[model samples]
Target: MTYPEIKRFHSNMLESITSHASQSPVYQDLETISDIARLSQLPLTTSTQIQNSFDRLGVEKVLLAPIARFWYTSGSTGKPKNVYYGKRDLDDIATGFFQLLYLCGARPWNNAWVVTAAGGETLFGLVVEKYGLDGTISPLAGEMDMIKALRHASRLHKIDIIVTTTWLYLLINKIAKEPKEFERLVETEVKKKVKIPVFSTIVTKYLLRGINYTRLGGSLQNAKIGFSHAEALSPYLAKIREAYPNLEMHDVFGAAEQWVQAIQVSPEKDWLSFFLRYSIPEIAPPEEVIKGKEDRNYRVKGVPWYEWKKGLKGELILTRPNECLPLVRYPTGDLIEVMDPAFSFEVNLERGKMKITLPAIKALGRAADSVDFAGADESGNFLGFKVYSRQVSDALMTIRNVRWWELYHVKGSPGKFVFLIIPENNVSDETAFKDELLRSLVNMFQEFTAAAQARAFLVGGTAAMEDQKNYLELMITRPTAYELIDTEIKQRIKEGRSVGQLKPKRIFVVDSDEALSTLTRKKMEA
Candidate 1:
């Protein structure tokens, strides 16, 4: 439902929730939600805001019982931003997550180790392990810890499931860190590599790199199935299927706040299903979980991009069972390609035997950070390029550092609306990287945006630009450095910053690639 409709619906929800129970700070907002149907009218809270709230709550671990733990790596031991989640949110995280696993043929009873965020002590890790019938589970934060956790979990006789964040697993599998040790554990006697089932919430280029490594290691032959959740799964997972021969790779979705599990991925005919097991799935405007302003672009410039897009792509709005916590239509950031109109209920010929069924769904990712670039016409109609911006976004997403992005192209000018990407994590020498990225980005966008892709480039925050002669500098080593400067200029235009307006990309930022090759190779090369 649109935010307004959801707001209207929330009036009844507010009455129902308030009358039924009184907990969570949002209880008071019921009135506000009922009154303000626009998404903007609601107060939005970011992960950062949530962290502040948690601090207000404190870490005694005493008052809240059935005491639950939440893990935070504190940001790679260096993560700049801090995010907070309640125990309840974490505990119920598996709805969509496990559905994807089931899609990939996860043995619910199999003992699997989860290697993900540092906050594993929270509800997510414990619940997955707890729900695991025979599934022995373990949680590890970051790369080294995941390796250690996996190594220790390998000792168990029946562990067959593995979960990890994008980087933690990528570093171990792709960088070949401690190759000898990794090989040993992968080839461990009790849990053979081929036999281990990997369940990641999502797979991006990082996981693509891992799949490549797994191909090289020849350990893939031992893996039974690979499951991706969290974010979109790259098509590269298909490579995992190729290398393993007997293995399958599936993408799953979920969060700390889902009411019931929703299977976001469309499975192959023979693939196992989850529609019947935990949650139901539907295609609609996502529920307004985040309290944001109404008039702003429905899609935020950059918070998290779901695989789902409107028209060409529809978001998978997860539904919550009323009996459960009642999370309805939560925006999962998962994007799905809506082809052939829509789909309806169907049977799981494969998992029907297992009794865990999945409902009918449609297209999902075959690439990373990929989005459906369905554009709007001058009047906001589908520009008929439902697929353009998506291609560019996927290419830009490959930067591996950005977290937020917007694709812009100028009208009637060689100046393409510039695609702006904000790094999710703090970065260094971004100007140099921008140039290096520009070249690659242009090449990537060329495949989709054609002439327009030439202009887009990656940009770092002000802190990283301190040394540069110009504010907006492209890495000499990167691609399409020239296009970046122009793109930014166009972005300003679109933002209504006029020729008289002096913005960073315009008068302040300069695209310089001097000596950027050496700098870029040093920065980007493996």
Candidate 2:
């Protein structure tokens, strides 16, 4: 049951290999994934290739699809990449999304509003609101427009569910909290609006921020259910629970590159149980990916999804039969941890109650994001320290009044680190802010640095260790500078960019002067 799509995947793989192997664009030479074993033999694929050369990636089937839709990622990595979906693929995704919505208490009678721009990831949610809900869907594009939409829907007493990104929700709440006439207007408008539920696919940091501002008026508190996905939920579920107490927070996991993978079986549980009806899943442990003297072949054989046991941590590999995109053992880049299977959970489907006990899964960021710092150990053995970007992001969230921020790792002989931040208006003490920010980063990254020191100690490279220590410079920007930076970002996006393609991380490695100059610009005429 875990790999119901295997036969289909094998057939597709065969067709692609026999018909288009030599001339196909993304992959030049390829082995056919005829069976589970052969699937393991296929080389891994990365997002970089998908972004830079998607047209070459088995596009024959895509061209032949009866109906095809194209969406591009927000070129945050440099250039926006296009993702193709066939009519059938989109229909499956839309159907799964709607089912998740229905499972989360949404109904056709409920007046739904989607507060996202009309592109990329938002398109899926828009589809769900349109197809799943019997109620009318109000698609609001921008933050101000979202507020207005909510107000209009509330005035009509028809707002049952409002869907938006967590950041936009926070922005709306922040504006409502301001002590201005506008705040009074928002408070009055919100108070008069219908108490509706909210759904968002967001990062945890913004969820906390949004929850803190939910009390601006009774409108947000009326939000009984909050469905979120696209990021880990367990880490921040407690905070969300404490904020609302009555709000039911559900997690739904999916990606633009792939269809919806999992959804919470129940609001009471923090598990995102995978649905086997989608793509066939496989798990590869972290250790197997590393090469040894005897084992030059590093990619470990991944276990089937059904074989997954609790506490198993590995990179998720998927095999899809969708003809528009034939993905065989494609490394999704997402690291996941397996959880216990649901004994039996019933979801009130559109027709009736459906029972399931699929194994739950937890995403642990991407393998690319967890960078490895290689050095020799005391015995002259090579040791690599994996520093997860999530650690840095988690530390950033700890800093009070930080509205948004980015950590840039500038490459050099001794690479320098720069932390740019936009603090909330209330954070006036810049000196204290810098001191606290530096302290937090140092503490969070202390273990990684210590590992480096131990590596130097083993190799007896004192000078090298000193250089490493010098490379760990952390710099924080002035709080108010983010306004100028924000303006510049908006201008760039306006020129033609989808927000979905933008990098979700505040931390990134900078390799060029052009990027540095743009990032370091401080003068503002506005």
Best by TM-score: 2
Distance from true position, residue 462, model 2, in Å? 14
Per-residue C-alpha lDDT of model 1 across residues 1-526, encoded as one tens digit per residue? 4334443554555444333222333222422232212322223333343344446765332122233333332221122332233455444455544544554567566655454433333444445555645433343322234445544444455435445433333433443334555454333422331343332212211222222332333342344555544433442343334434554455444444332244433444312122432332344332333322242224322211122232444444433323222322334444454432223333244537333322333334222223223334331211233333334444555565543444433332112234445553445777665776677664654444432222222234444323222212232222233334435433443433211121131111112233333323432332
**What does candidate 2's lDDT look like per residue over 1-526, in tens digits?**
2244544654555555434432435555665444554555655555554444545444443333443676654444445556666677676677767776777787666655454444633465546545655333344333234444444444433345555444444544445455254444444434444244232212212222322222333454455666555455554455445544555666667665665788775866656877766666788865554421124244558877656788777778776655354555566667777876433578887589977667787666667565444543221221344455556656765555666666666655434566666665545666787778878877876876786577666766786677555534444455556656555544544544543322245556676546765766672111
- Candidate lDDT scores, in order, read 0.37, 0.56
TM-score of every model? 0.48, 0.68
Query: Which model scores highest in lDDT?
Result: 2
Question: Per-residue lDDT for 390 in model 2?
Answer: 52
Clash pairs (backbone) in predicted model 2: 25-56, 26-56, 26-57, 73-501, 74-501, 108-134, 108-135, 378-458
